[model samples]
Target: MDTSLLFWNNIISTCGVPRIITSDRDPKFTSELWTNLYDMLGTKIPFSMAYHPQKDGLSERMIQTMGISLGDHLNKNLLSIHPTAKDVHDMWKKACEKDAKCIAEAKEYNKQRWDKSHKEPDSKEGDQVLVSILNFNNLKGPKKMRDSFLGHFTIIKLIGKNEVEVRLTKDFSRKHPVFPVILIKPYFQTEEYRFPSSKKNPTAPEIVEVEDSPGPVKRIIKASKIRLNGKDQRQYLVRFKNQTADKDKLLAEDAIPDANLHLRRFRASRRTE
Candidate 1:
C-alpha cells in the first residue's frame, strides 16, 4: 500500500484530523510508523484501551449481537431459495434443510406467521380476557379499550365460539350490558409469577404486574391501589335509588338514609411516569 496517500486520504475523508484517535494496539495500529504519521498530522494518538476481564463480557455480548445480525442478513438473502426449502432435506441437502439457521426454515417460520390457515382462538362465555379497541380512530367508543382489559368480561351471549358476548365495562354504560368478544384479547401476563404484598395479611390482594392499556397519550402512573365500586355505584347496580317506598317503607328508608358515592377517574388511570 502507498502509505502516504493511504494515510492522508483517510484523514481528508474524515472531514479533518480528529483531536484524538483511540485504537486497539494491533500490529498495524501500534506501529511506530503509524504513531509518527499521526504526530505529523497534528492529531493526538490515544492508544487502544487495554481489555479487562470484566469488561470483556461486553465484548462477548457484542459478538453475539453481530452473529444475530449476520444470521438475519443470510436469512434475508435466502428468500429467493424459499420455495426449495422443503426439498433441501431430499434434493439440495446442503441448502434446503430445515434449520433454525437455514433460509428454508426461516421461510417456513414466516409462512406460519402470515398464513391464514391456522384456526382462530375461541372467545367464549366465562373466559377472562383483555380488550383492544378495533379502531379508536371511531369518534366515540370506550375512548381506549379499558386497561387493555375493559376483565373477566363474562360472555353473557355467544355470537360464535371465536366471537361471543362479553360484559361491557362500567366506563361504557351500565345499560349497555353485553359487548362482542372481538373487543377482547386473552388476558395474559408475560411474567412467570407474582408476589404477595404482605405476608402477614392473607386476605390482602397479591402484588402482581399488569399491563397498561395504551391511553390517548402516555399516562402519568402512580403507585396506589383503588377500589372500583363504592356504596353508591353498588346501589345504582341494585336499583335501590329507583324503588317506590310505601308509608311503612318510608320510615325504614329514613332510618337507612341515602349516601352519595362519587366515581370519576379510574384507578391508576393516568400516570406521570
Candidate 2:
C-alpha cells in the first residue's frame, strides 16, 4: 500500500492529479486506502469490467507507442555514438543474425519436445472435437475431479494453422470460440452393442413439442446501469423458468416486456432496501 501511494504521489507531483482514472480490478487499485485517497482528491475511478480490458484501449495503445518510440530513439543514439555508419550497420546485422539463430534453435527444441508427447493433430474444418477444460473455471465440482474435456462440438473453421474456431453453445459465451489445436482432441463415437437385449421396455413416454416464446421469466436476479452509445441504460440479469443460474442472460430493460411486473417488484424491493 505504501509503495503504491508513493508511486502515485510521484506521478501526481509530475503530471498533477488527474480528474478521472481508469484501471482494471487489481487488488492494489481496489483497496479501501486507494479508494479513500481518490475520493478525497475528487477523482473518479472507473474500473474496467471483469474480462473486459478494451475500456482502457487508448492508454494501452499510448503505452505501446511510447515503448516503440523509446526503442527507436535509443537505437539512434547508439548509432550516433558509433564512429561510422558502416560500424552501426555491421553491429545491427550481427544482432539480427544471432537473433535468427537463437529463434531457429528454440523452434527446433520445442518441436522435438512436442513430438515426444503429442502427435500432430489431424483436425480440419467441420470435424467434431472435444475441448480441454483446463482454461475454463465454469464447471462444477473440484477442478481435479471434474471432466478434463468437454464437448463433441463441431469445428466452425480453421483459424490460422494453430487454432480452430468451434461452434459453442450459449453457456460458453464468456469464452472465445477459438481454441488451440493442442487443447482439442478428435471425438469418436462409441461402438453400438454387438448383442441385442432379450426383453423390451413395457412403456415409453410420449414426447411433447412446445412452441417457444421467450421462456417465462423466473425472476430478475440483478440489475446494473451501463453506458451504451453515449447514453445510460439499465440491463437486468434474468433467469428464466426451467433454466439454471449458469444460464441466466443479461438483457436490456426494454427487451424484457413479458417481465415488466417482475421488474416493478424488483425495483420496489430495491427502494425498500
- Per-residue C-alpha lDDT of model 1 across residues 44-144, encoded as one tens digit per residue: 66553445324345555665689999887567547476866546557655443444357767788888987767556676657666555443232345654
Q: Pairing residues by index, what is the TM-score of model 1? A: 0.23
Q: Model 2 off-target regions past 4 Å?
A: 1-119, 191-273
lDDT of 2 by residue, 1-273 (tens): 565577577877799777667666888788886777776677677776545556776776666689999887666566567657557678899999999999999999999998899776778889989999978877888777888899978998997789999998778877889999989988877533323455456688889996464578888989999999999988999888897888788888777767679888888988998
Per-candidate local distance difference test: 0.50, 0.80
Top model by TM-score, which number? 2
Best by lDDT: 2
Task: Return the clash pairs for model 1, or none.
Answer: 23-48, 88-96, 131-148, 219-271, 220-270, 220-271, 220-272, 221-271, 221-272
